[model samples]
Target: MSKHNVYKMSVASVYPLLVAKAEKKGRTKSEVDEIIRWLTGYSQEELEAQLKKQTDYENFFAEAPKLNPSRALIKGVICGVRVEDIEEPIMREIRYLDKLIDELAKGKAMDKILRK
Candidate 1:
């Protein structure tokens, strides 16, 4: 008793890529279709909203949280955070920093900088 569904996604440009992944994973086209169907049980608008929230939270905390300009630095604030907690190792390269700054400089978004 297999409970699966066949559905379509309007991923026009990347449709070929999705098919290629399915093939690479040795899954039938219908199997891929079923997985997509299960995922799409969530409304597109809801998924997009969740994605936006995730993106916003990730961007907001990309840098280490700092003490407010006028506020005192408590022992808890400094001691509670680990080096890895504040700095994401994946984004530690100079190339990444330059690219991030350049993207923000385009005026599309503002990524705050953390000064030690």
Candidate 2:
């Protein structure tokens, strides 16, 4: 799929799947929320608003209060693509979230997942 198509996907559509991925491994939705907040700098209210608004991935990220400086530190393969090798900036952000969710599903410690 084209990067533009992925960018247009609704965050609401993906959020539940991310929660489920973590939940299956005994992780809480709040932890998923925390990871997202840590990466995007969204407040609890802003996050909730985005969830309710069903924002698109592009806008969800574009409007982020802050994209953590440390997100550049998230490096790994996700969906057969190295996170650090992604050429598109927005797509890289999406993969960063994907990688974090994958780590959360795999039971990676929160501090490390948050790049602390």
Candidate 3:
């Protein structure tokens, strides 16, 4: 799908897939939640509210209470593209989450995966 189409897709629809990816590799959904919270600065309740609202990705990141500055430390490739090299801000945020989930699935420690 094109970037525009991806931006319009509901985060709720995509959330399960992220969770499933980690779960398939013996990770828990809680780890996925922690990753998201670390990246977006969303409290668990706010994250759940966004999911229930079926917010699209563009708005999900846009409306985040505080997009973590530490996210810039999340340097790596996701989908063959180095996330730190992405120019479009929203796309970078998306890829950051993807990379985190990828790390979780790869059995990377939570402290390192979170860039803590």
Judging by TM-score against the true structure, name the best candidate: 2
Q: Which one is best on lDDT?
A: 2
**On a 0 to 1 TM-score scale, where does candidate 3 land against the true structure?**
0.95
Off by over 4 Å in 2: 1-3
- Over 2-83, each residue of candidate 3 has an lDDT whose tens digit, in order, gives 5767888888999999999999999999999999998998999999999999999999999999998988999888899999
Root-mean-square deviation per candidate: 20.0, 1.5, 1.8
The CA lDDT at 85 in model 2 is 98
Candidate 2, overall lDDT? Answer: 0.95
Q: What is the TM-score of each candidate against the true structure?
A: 0.26, 0.96, 0.95
Q: Which portions of model 3 show Cα errors greater than 4 Å?
A: 1-3
Candidate 2 on 7-46: residue-level lDDT in tens?
9999999999999999999999999999999999999999
The alpha-carbon lDDT assigned to residue 86 of candidate 1 equals: 36
